[model samples]
Target: MRATVDFAPLFRSSVGFDRMLNALDLASRIPTVDNWPPYDIVKTGEDDYRIDMAVAGLAENDLTITQERNTLVVTGRKAQEPQSAAEYLHRGIAGREFERRFDLAEHMKVTDAHFENGLLSITLKREIPEAMKPRRIAITSSTTRAEEAVPQIEARKEAA
Candidate 1:
């Protein structure tokens, strides 16, 4: 009951975007993927972004955030507790271990992270390198004729 999406047309026009397109294709195929511990991605500014995840029972020590070359991983591991006489009659909040991954674009860097009121906020900024930025080329027009622009080569004389 799933409809497949064709990305052949996009592949012809885009370069270096195969990974992103493939990821989208895979995501479409797997519709029942784990969605525990809901999270939201928000764009605050033109080059600034934030990911806020609601982890009700997890503490700062229970979670780990890692930023690799082009991926961000968020993992939560709940500490095992000793057996208590009090048993949960109706358990609602999720306290299980979970790992979530996010694909990041090039030049994206993680700047800060904050844990407040059962929510983890991760801030990211896009910083393009100086070499990668576009620059204007200088075009100079001189009054000199085309003859002066060419360099003349002199013939070498044979020595006795």
Candidate 2:
């Protein structure tokens, strides 16, 4: 039994959160999909992340990673088997093609990807642009500036 979530209240009260809400909706609808090629997402650092996928029989050339806006897509297609291949009595490792998508947060980007020991590792870094980072603004009191200027002006007038 799948529980449905209604985001009507969130949609009505929030602005500029459409992407987050859409991601939530997408996650809620993921129960029907195949869970082949299991993966793990880990936070390596404060702003760095890694996704390790268990692609047992896939080679480096069999995988393709793409980034479109805030979405990261990882696809794998196994090479065609030769006609003279030996038949296996019991086949367990999955060589089937799969496409996995990850919805990244703002500023998240794929830095690198490599395969080793039957595992595909994808590195991600959240690189917030300098313009988008939080900055401190110096606050000055107008009243203090006015008072200092008035005293200076009065002193100049008395001298004159």
- Clash pairs (backbone) in predicted model 1: none
How good is model 1 by TM-score?
0.82
In model 2, which regions exceed 4 Å deviation?
147-160
User: How does model 2 score by TM-score?
Assistant: 0.85
Could you say which candidate leads in lDDT? 1
TM-score winner among the candidates? 2
How does each model score on lDDT?
0.91, 0.90
Tens-place lDDT per residue, model 2, 13-48, is: 999999889889888987756787999999999999
* Model 2: residue 66 alpha-carbon error in angstroms: 1.0
Give lDDT tens digits, candidate 1, residues 49-142: 9999999988889999999899999999998878999989998888889999998999999999999999999999999999999999976557
